[model samples]
Target: MGNIDKRNRLDEAPFRYAVTKTNTVFIDYEGKQIKVLKGKEAEKFLKRVNAADSEKELQLIMAKITGNFKRGNER
Candidate 1:
């Protein structure tokens, strides 16, 4: 496996961080990578982290964002 893969697997739990490339940014939760966020969306994500809420909330937010993305793409 690649180094990043090995590192992720070696840890007892997943890591969280914002991934940035080009003009996009997203939060990585567990092994899932989201890539449909910017500006206010990013601010909201950071606020979630700062609020010290559960991972479930983050997952829900990710799901919501993903859902919106899928819907938008379908149009």
Candidate 2:
């Protein structure tokens, strides 16, 4: 088997399931994995990822993407 085939069955299977079928989504940013909704939500999340300056920035971005923050915690 080739590298990809061998890697896919490795001890550490680095993957995550975002959505299914037409709404499916997957994100691997700087070696980290993220899953967000599709359509407009995905667009907004991508913008945040593009704007991230640090790992903290990315996490905050993800929190915003997932709507996990209260109004007081969002920027």
Candidate 3:
């Protein structure tokens, strides 16, 4: 209850941006955070990854709702 009541705390939701602090650059991925990126490369990389994940999830959900069935591709 105490942790939840911390009004000044900020949490990262899905696709939320997380700014890190360091003297150099970094490249962060799932299960990985390396200091090889330059400038805002890390942030761009994270945004791209998040967008890709969201796109994939949306595609899956859309397929399910639209009836994911396989048949001859007759157009």
Candidate 4:
């Protein structure tokens, strides 16, 4: 016998989903859906994603999240 647990890990994700299969959208603090990326809007956000501060922040945050994964047995 084996103890196998099934859980939706996306519920445990720390980040928000910005881009889906096609459209790019995000929710604001007011809970309003904001579609500010994709098409012409992507140009505006490109600089931020490529900036030094943004790159450093991304590395730091992703490192913490990727390092926090746990196996099903450990859960």
Name the top TM-score candidate: 2
lDDT of each: 0.50, 0.48, 0.35, 0.38
Rank all candidate structures by their lDDT, best first, as comma-separated numbers.
1, 2, 4, 3
Model 1 stretches with alpha carbons more than 4 Å out: 1-24, 27-34, 68-75
User: For each candidate, what TM-score against the reference?
Assistant: 0.41, 0.42, 0.24, 0.29
Candidate 4 achieves a global lDDT of 0.38
Off by over 4 Å in 2: 1-35, 69-75
In order of listing, the candidates' clash counts read 0, 0, 0, 0
Candidate number of the best lDDT: 1
Which lDDT tens digits does candidate 2 get at residues 1-75?
233233232223223234457654565333555554688766665676678675545554554454433344322
For candidate 1, give the lDDT of residue 45: 61
Q: What TM-score does candidate 2 reach? A: 0.42
Worst 10 residues of 3 by lDDT: 8-17
lDDT of 1: 0.50
Query: What TM-score does candidate 3 reach?
Result: 0.24
| Lowest lDDT 10-residue stretch of candidate 2 | 4-13
Across residues 6-73, which tens digit of lDDT does each residue of candidate 4 receive? 35433343333255555453422123343345655554444444562643354333323334334544
Error of 2 at 24 (Å): 4.7
TM-score sort, best first: 2, 1, 4, 3
